[model samples]
Target chain A: MSRRTALAGAVAITALLLQVTVIDRLHLPAGRPDLALVCVVAFALVGGPTYGAVLGFGVGFLADIMPPADHTIGLLALAYAVVGYLAGLVEDVEERSVVTTVLMVGLASAVAVVVFAMIGALLGNAHISLSAVAHSLAATVIYDVVLAPFVVPLVSGAVRHAEPAG
Target chain B: MRDSRRARLVLALLLLTAFTLITLDFRSGGGGPFRTVGNTVFGPIERAVTAVTRPIGSFFASLGHLNSYKSDNAKLRAQNRKLLEELRTSDANRAHLLSLERLDHLAGQAQFRIVAARVVAIGNALDFEWTATIDAGSNDGVRRNQTVINGDGLVGKTLAVGPTTSTIRLGADPEFTAGARLAGTQESGFVDGGGHNPMTFTMLNTRAPLNVGDRLVTAGDTDNHDRPFVPEVPIGRITRVLPTPGQLYRKAVVAPFVDFTSIDIVGVVVAAPRTVPRDSLLPPSPSPTPTPGPGGTGGTGGTGQQSPPPSPGTTSGRRSTSPSPSRTP
Candidate 1:
């Protein structure tokens, strides 16, 4: 448990640093692949459903630190926790299907977006139209979907490493 | 029901947090968070960027060292000699230009030195106001009043300079105004900034022969020169000219040569070129020296100094809009 938490923190922090200093500059204008979200997703997948909630909290808290984010700071924490907790549902599947990975990340991404929008709505963050944000949402969904199949295995392999030497 | 109820509670809390964030953000417009995060988070990132760039810089330095190994010493010597000769020539040419302007404002010129600096920050357009940070400041002899300039024109003047950073107040800033002259005929005017509105250059009579493409240069401080100082350096070129009916002077829209927002590197004029009579700097030279002592003493000693010397009228120092005594074509 201790090892997993440290690994998750390190992986997530590295991705966060790169996202701000580099990926932020690479603003493809379409929504950027939320590397932090992906990292949280990966960690939660490996760490089990309940632990995924904890990882979500970490990632959500990270998002609050950026300049552009508005009120309802804890929305991310709650949203990510739920996303993580759900990832634990299929933790034991040995040979995860590519279709399954794609669907899970896609669904996860949609959930993340909806949660963010909902948070904004609650905060009365002037109702931004979904039409306006569709491109970013599309970009994120596509990126997360494409990344998941490759990422799940890597995440699983990392978790295997976390097991003690026989 | 129990699990659903807990999840709903969590969602409620999240919604509440979002509401609070919105209120804080709406009121602060990201100022508090940006500063806090900039220091805690972005500051480290900037430091890391510096660290990463430092290696590249050092590599370039070594590459420079390696390439210059053979000819560096000889090149330095030759460059030094050339610079010394060029300095002497510039000194003479500057004196000539000063003399021409001296025909207008006769006061001794203020000594200045030039230094080059690089831009570090360009303020965002969305929030506060636009400002730029230059790499040189007090450490480089840049001071508050000394202007920041690029090749095309004045970027702004130094507002504050630190050891490694300096903030420039752009010519377009509302607080800034400079005395300017129409280059073609050296007709003088005062230029004022009005935010995004077209900057204005107002002359007393509105009849100065201003034409499109006419350039403007820094007219030295009139307070110091009772007569408006002859323009020492070009600031910008006229883009639009408006001459009022029945007026003898006109105003023009000036497009500054320096793109204040995009400036990356600039040369600061260390000294305003002063063309004091050449004899003044030389000892016992040809130019008649003003005698020292309160009552202007000299051979004839009729109260020594020339009193009210050829009065041009009281100097009305241009307060940006200052209309002081001035002479030009």
Candidate 2:
């Protein structure tokens, strides 16, 4: 595998571990920030649609089967795969303004939550109430947006550093 | 253009695989081989991470609650003084004797055999489920469907058990439900977790007398094993009685006694009490006397003897029945 791909994979796994262990335990108001999702979006923005989609699937799969997760497996995988692909399509990552990138991250976070709830509903997961879904959607978007600036640039910089200069 | 097409093809294949995995997992009721393998591989790692980061996590937790520490300290000090005063009074002696009598009655009963465990990690942020992983597992005699409780009250039940770890579904999870009984009345119902909202208790008897502040305890199962919950474990107090003009069952909102967000140490009941503890396990009711003047205090001391002080960290002080002494003449 290419160095960039390997670095992205390593980054994604670290983000997943930190997300479940430290970030989720913080119990931040509204909702905890989704570091793994942010990392996936960052990688997608740096590498494009195909890379983002694959990374998202890998990360989401780990999340689904992770200890303490009782939900149907692949539910997160499906939601995040779509999110990664959509994020990668933001177009001209090098030319995009900071404001645009941050906005896109917020939008992606919101979409990931919504799609997760939607798929949860489809799979007969009764826990997905309308009000709960809406509350989490709002919380996830706000927290992720607040977190995007720090995470996105850091992840993108690392990926770029790993890129082979032409 | 060719690269984009190949990328799209890859996306399609990945999506297809995800869907297939979901189908296989859902059809298997989430107990597929993948789940077992994942637990075996990741459970220890997660446990270690939780152990290493707990101090850091608690540091931030305390930081969040820094504002409440002052008031809490003052309240505790006041309570200590009151308890000390009660100890000196002759009336308090009589009350203590009465509790001893009750304890005598419980002397021959079967005791709960519990496996104590520490919460190692919480559920992931992305999922809506409220669950926590405990460090004890099958090796520690922990099993699926065992009731998990802390000092305050019921926390949740074990969902899945690994060799060295187990996952518990907290009482706040929307999908969680447990049979509950009114403390004094013996009126039975089931409690449902409301996620971010208060738990709901629906009584089986449509016309059962319901009131605010009435406490609930686990009804437990008729079977001797008590597979999921033991009888008489405190659940919560009734918060709001929903107006049901023509409903078949009475519904009320309940605030659970345990703080699901901050669970630290919990015990899994491997063996239940021989005789149901009944309402004896519920926290002592708040003082009945509104104004414990010298004369009134003597008379009310007997009532205090009936129940022991509330368990530490129960937050029952706020729900005391009597108005604060400062407010009384």
Instruction: Provide fnat values for all models in the order shown.
Output: 0.06, 0.66
Clashing pairs in 2: none
* Model 1, position B166: C-alpha lDDT score: 51
Give a tens-digit lDDT track for model 2, residues A1-166.
3888788778877777677677766767656788889888888887778888998899899888877888889988988898888888774455877788788888888888887888788988867988888888888888888899898889878866777471
lDDT of 2 by residue, B262-310 (tens): 6666667777755775677777767331211223212334666654444
What TM-score, computed on C-alpha atoms, does each candidate reach? 0.44, 0.80
Give lDDT for model 1.
0.52
User: Which is the leading candidate under DockQ?
Assistant: 2
**Per-residue lDDT over B1-329 for candidate 1, one digit per residue giving the tens place of the 0 to 100 score:** 01344544544555465456546654665444533542344333433443353323332232223222222233423433443454444554344223223211211222323455544343311111234545555555655566655444556676544544455656765546888765434457778653344566766545335556656666667555312222354466667877577766566787776555445445455455444222221112133322222222222437636443423233232234656658896
Off by over 4 Å in 1: A67-79, A121-127, B1-29, B33-38, B49-329
Query: Could you tell me the lDDT of residue B224 within candidate 1?
Result: 54
